[model samples]
Structures are given as C-alpha cells and as structure tokens.
Target: MLVRIRGAWFVAVGVVVAVVATALLLVTRAGADTDRCTRFRDAADDRAGLVTGVGADLLVIGDSYSVGLGVGAAESWPTRLPGRVRVGGFSGSGFSRGASPCGDVSYAARAARDLPESEIVVVEGGLNDFDQPAAAVEDGFERLLARLDDRRVLVVGPAPAPERAAAVPAVDALLADLAREHGVGYLSMAEADLPYLDDGLHLTVEGHRQFGDLVAGALSTARQPGR
Candidate 1:
C-alpha cells in the first residue's frame, strides 16, 4: 500500500507486516507468564540499580518498543536514561514504513525539520522492518542517516528476538554496514544479555534498564579521550 506521511510518499510496506511486527514486539513485554527477568526485578526505588553514567540530553527516535509500549512513562527505558530524554516515534514504525500509515513523521524527516540540541541522538528502529525487503530498509535507513550526518549519533541495530533468530545475522550486518557507511557509532544488541519478555521479542523493564545502561556507557565511552 502507498502511505503518505509527513509529506512523503511511502510504498510497499504492509500494514499486516507492521501489525505482525507489533505482535512480536509485544511478545516480549510483561505478563507472558514465562519471563524470569522479573524474577530478578528490584524494588521501585531500585531503578538506579542497573547502571548510571554522566547523563546527557538525548533524543531517541524509535518505534513503540523505544517509546515503551504497554509500560508507564516513568517505567519506560528512555525515561530511565540518566539524562533529559525525549522519546518520539510511531508504535509500528520502521525504515520501510518511513512515511508511516499512521501519519507519524519519519525519523529522518523529523530530524531534518527539528533536532533539538543534545549530547547525542539515537536513531533506532528496524525490528518492525524485519520482514521488509532489505532494499527498502536500507533505503529508509540511508535517507534518515543522511539527514543526521551533522549530528553526534549512534545507530542501534535490532536485538536478537527469538522470532527473528534465523534472520538476525543478515539484518544485523545490514545495519552495521549502514552505520559504517555513515561513520556513526553502532551498537549490536543481537547477542547482548538483554532479557526479552515472553514472546521473546519485547524487552521487560529490567531489559530496558540494561539497554539504557548500555547506551549510556557507549555515550560515555564516545566522549572519552582519543582512543
């Protein structure tokens, strides 16, 4: 289907595809009844237990997963970041669906129009594009990164979700290549020790904390002296 979002015409990405991705995205959320990540959950006040670093104002552009669907604002990972964090992205967004059906602006376009001053910017998505054609995914990624060329940015590849176990390598490689092509930092969460909810795709609160810590560490390391 052709979708016009934020003045751009998008074609080929499927609503059903995005829907399936959303389903997978939720699979790893809470209430799955098989999650052990929560077995190690700390008290509410223990939110700082994961890891903390010198916070920096951060802009995170991602999908529902990044926005913390099914979770409270304070409990969302972005909110947990040790800095001023602004979270924005459509729930089922992806590179392929840049001009989203829901009228959400594409990340690249959003950055082009208005990217707030921040220490770092995170451009995340793609898990929702898992089933999409690589060509389209790359096209979208490239367009977005092109607009972000002037910013200190990090490109986070998709995580290793059980549902995408087999295709992880190719997708991860594509994302890594894209990041390298633009000379931006890239983080591979495919093999990271993040705890997935139940559907084995979405991340639990603890998982978000861990991921946030990872991002924070990377940001810290990036600002370190010449290495």
Candidate 2:
C-alpha cells in the first residue's frame, strides 16, 4: 500500500539524518582533542629548546606560573613582554631542585648558559621557595644576580594568594634590597592591578596583557636617555 511505502521512506530519511548528526559530533570532539594535544606538544617542544640552549635578549625564568599553563605561548607575560623579551621558563621549573615535585632544573643555571648579553633580564620565581627559609631564597637570588653583572634585572614578585599576600610585603622588601645592592630594578605582581588572575595565581588572558604593559613601561623608563 502507498501508506506502507511512505512510512518506510520516512524511516530511511530519519536514519540518514541521525547518522550525519553522529558523524558531525564525532568530528567536533576529535578536532577539540587534536587542538589540546597540539598545545601540549608545542609547550613540550619549547621546553626542550630551553634545555638545549637557545639564547634570547630578554630571558624570563620561572616555574609553571611563569609557563602560563592552559594559556597560549603568545598570551604568556614573558612572550608578551615588550622590548625584545623571550621565554626561558619551563613549565614546573623552579629556582632550586626539589622545590616542586615537577621541577628539577635550576632556573639560574639555565639563564646563565642560555641568555645573551642583553639590557634586561626578568626573573619571576619564589613561590616554590616560600616553604623554605627566606635566607635560602635570597642566597639563590643573589647567585643569579651576580651572574648577570650590570644587566638591568627585574625580579617579578609572586602573586597574591589569599593567605600568602600577608608575607609578600616582607618578601618584596627583601627583593628590593637585593635589587638596590645590584643596581637592578624590581617589579612586583602585587603592585600591578591584576583583574585577570585565572585562579588567584596565574594571569588570565587579560591579566597577561596588562602585565605586559607594565613590563614595557618599566623597560622604557629604565632605558630612558637620562635615568
């Protein structure tokens, strides 16, 4: 009968539509996974470059916080840093070995070997050293600065943790003294108005932009004809 024929046609059309829809869903999911995998691989490759010795004008050294995990390389503050800045920080790296379960390489040693003779050097690590004594952090920092000689240094202070911000003042003071002794400038994340912290720690996309602006301003001032 005509009714039976029409019913079969409708069922066939519905099946075709369902198959197409399922295929689209799978394709979309696969694309997303591929993108994530690509980002991971890119980050890993960048780290390898650092370990193998790639020098740059402005070397940024730090840990995961500096690595800008979950954020693109261009969105990282170091990459965004103006006036010839380059990335040297590896994800999960710290100032001293055993500082973090993920960190083994010494940031200072990496900088000494990999950084070129540049006017500016930005060092952004210390949170991992918080559990350790202040003296240890200071000593490690001192060694790093000594290697830089007279190159302008900007020691980036840690972000504001709900509880850790209280200790930042003391830490900032110590960092300031160190900078003065070495004739280097220091910049603190606490001083910058960070409305873009992803989780009270890492800078969000907007935060990275703002932080980059601050770094540029500092570099400009330091490199001014007079001061």
Candidate 3:
C-alpha cells in the first residue's frame, strides 16, 4: 500500500512539473514574439524615414492588414495610398486587447504614443476585437479617440472576411456608431467584396490596391469644398 501511495505521489508530481513547463514555454514564446515585433517596427520605421521623426501627410495605425504581412512592402496598401503615408501596423493587435499573438501593442496604446505629425490620422483595424466584449471595445475606441483629439482622425472599420463574416458586421456597426458619437469620419467596408488569401482573412495584393483606391477617393472627397 505504501509503495502504491508513493507511485501515485510521483505521478502527481510529474503532472505538476509538466504543467509548469508548458506554462514557461508559452511565456517564453510570447516574449520572443513581442521582441520580434519590436524589431520589425524599428526596421519599418527606418525604411519609412520615420526614424528621422519626420511627419507624413497621413498616419495609419492598424494591424496586419495595414502591415501587408504576407506581401512585399511595395504591395502593401499604404504604399499605394496617394501622398506621403506612414504606417503603424502590428499583427494580432486590436483596440480592446494587448499581448496578442504578435505583441503587446494595441490601437489604444499606439494612439497614446508620441506619433509622428500628420495632416490626417487614420485609425484602422478592429476585427481582432471581435471576440472581446462590446463594452471593452467601446472603451478602447474612446481611449483611442481621446488620445487623437487634436488630430484630423478617420476611423476605418474592418472589412469582412469569409472566415469571420458573421462577426464583422457587429464590429463594424460598433465602430461606425462610435465614430458618429465622436464626430469623426467613419468608413465601413462590411459589404466590400475584396479578394483574400487562402486563410480568407488577409487581403491579396489586388485587394490592397482596391482598398487603397477606395480610401484615396474618400480622402479626396472629404477635402472637397463643402464636403
């Protein structure tokens, strides 16, 4: 009986150790991912002349869609945008949550940071906040708008993806409502039929071009007299 008890205790200890190890591994991986994101951001800044602290005509703060994660820099939508544009995009980031798959960056956090000066600031990407509570997402949007109170701000709602189609409209509606309440211009892509990659989430190069043109046109329209 004593031997059996000892064996059970040993098995229990092993399970505990395994759980601890798995947790450590996850933490380590998360830290590594965060570090990688920081490096990528720094490199992007260098490439975009942001390292010089020079401002651009437009500043876009968003997630992987803005970064053109799977495509070349030139193929990214921001590059297709007219005039000088600076992009602040991180993967797996959203307004309501941080410490995501890519890093601890969130839209609210990005807005709170000292951003480069720009004539127009566009806050994009809220799809990641789909699973989060409505109250949390609203709070995040409020915080972000509060930070950019002095800037000409536009809120771009996330486009629909085949994989997440059901959740897109809710987020889009919430963003549109918030934009209206905050007196900011809001663009809704909930009904946009854009090409997507195999994952049915990220946009293709062609999709980027389409999106860029749409936004460029919107900007032009907004700039017109009596707009």
Candidate 4:
C-alpha cells in the first residue's frame, strides 16, 4: 500500500510540473506574438494612405522632429507645406541598423519602398543618431539620399537644443554638405526663430505652427510654378 501511495504522489508531481511548464511556454509564446503584432500594427498604421486625397506631389520623410513632435498630424509642417505635401514620418524613428522602435522596418528601406516619386523629397533625421558615430549617421543619410536618385531632395538639419546648440552647427554643416553633394535643397530649421520649442528639442503647439509657417515659406518658393 505504501508503494502504491508513493507512486501516486510521484505521478501527481509529474503532472503538476508538466502543467506548469506548458503554462510557461504558452505565456512566453503569447508575449512574443503580442510584440510582433504590435510592431506590425504600428507599421501598418504609420504607412496608411497618408497621401490619398491630398493631391501631394511632394513626399516628406523623417523622425519625430520632422513630423512635428507633440502636435497633431494636421499641425505638422508637411501637412502645412504648400502644394499638397504628404508626410511619411514616424516618431522615435532613427536611421539605425537595428529594428526601429516605431516598427520592424528600417527607415531607409521604408523610405525606398513608400516614398512617392516627387519633385521634392524632404529628408529629416539626425537627433536620434546623436549616440551613433558620425560615420554611421552620414552613411544612413547617404543611403537615404541614394534612393532619391535625381529627385530634388531637401535635408533639413537638426533643431537647436540649449545643451547641444554649440554642437548643432557641426551637424547642420554636415547635413548641408550632404545635400549639396547630392544636389538637393537644404533647409536649416536650426536657424529659424521658434520660441515654442519645449526642452529645446520637441516643439510645442506654437512651435509646430511656426515650423509649418517656415516650411510653407520654403515650399512656396521651391514649388514649381502653378503647382
């Protein structure tokens, strides 16, 4: 009888262990699936028909700064840009090699795939590359511009940060050189007078308005006649 009891106890423990292991495996799988789903959903939402019905012949691509951080989509500079500009920016996006926080897609790859053939292609991104080596930043920018081919590109330099304003000039100069080398237009928002930049990085609502106006002025001058 004691032998039978021992056997039963062993069986019960084995079953319990198996159940716990299965539960753990299932939980892990569910978490991974959830993460992949979230990434895909965010990418899909970001890539949704932004240019539809806008009559945009221009495409704008960049990180949160270019998208008008802390502001609604309507208040973005691309939205406010004259001649129906379509915006293809994602927040927290960088020109890094690893998986993007905004999505699983690489910024350069996404730009090549999603960017429309436009007379004007505004490429803005660099702040996120602060920690990365300057070579990496330049390489990413070069790759992005390579995809533009003969298209008229505009490389908007980084914004001014009170802590980094001194360094801003060098970064802006690099971007300017890149644009010139690629034969594209360049806009330096770092020189613009925008008092609405909170924390010297992201823009406030008023800042967004000011950026939109700045972009509008640039586009007004750059846009093809009657466009």
lDDT (CA) for every model shown? 0.64, 0.62, 0.75, 0.65
Candidate 1 C-alpha lDDT tens digits along 109-128: 65666666677777676677
Identify the runs in model 1 with alpha carbons over 4 angstroms from their true place. Answer: 1-56, 98-105, 220-227
- lDDT per residue for candidate 2 within 1-227, as digits (tens), equals 89999999999999999999999999998887567546544674574354222344666677655566656565666655654555666554445554544333566666666766666767776655656566766667766766776666677766664445676666666766766666666677666666545355566777777776676667643321112
Model 1, CA-based lDDT = 0.64
Show the lowest summed lDDT stretch of 10 residues, model 2: 218-227
Clashes per model (N, Cα, C within 3 A): 2, 0, 0, 0
Provide the global lDDT of candidate 3 against the true structure.
Answer: 0.75
Highest lDDT among the candidates is held by which one?
A: 3
Candidate 4 regions exceeding 4 Å error are 1-48, 51-56, 96-106, 163-166, 197-200, 220-227
Total residue pair clashes for candidate 4: 0
Ranking by lDDT: 3, 4, 1, 2
Q: Determine the C-alpha RMSD for candidate 1 after optimal superposition of all C-alphas.
A: 13.9
In model 2, the number of clashes is: 0
Top model by TM-score, which number? 3
Looking at model 3, residue 205 earns an lDDT score of: 95
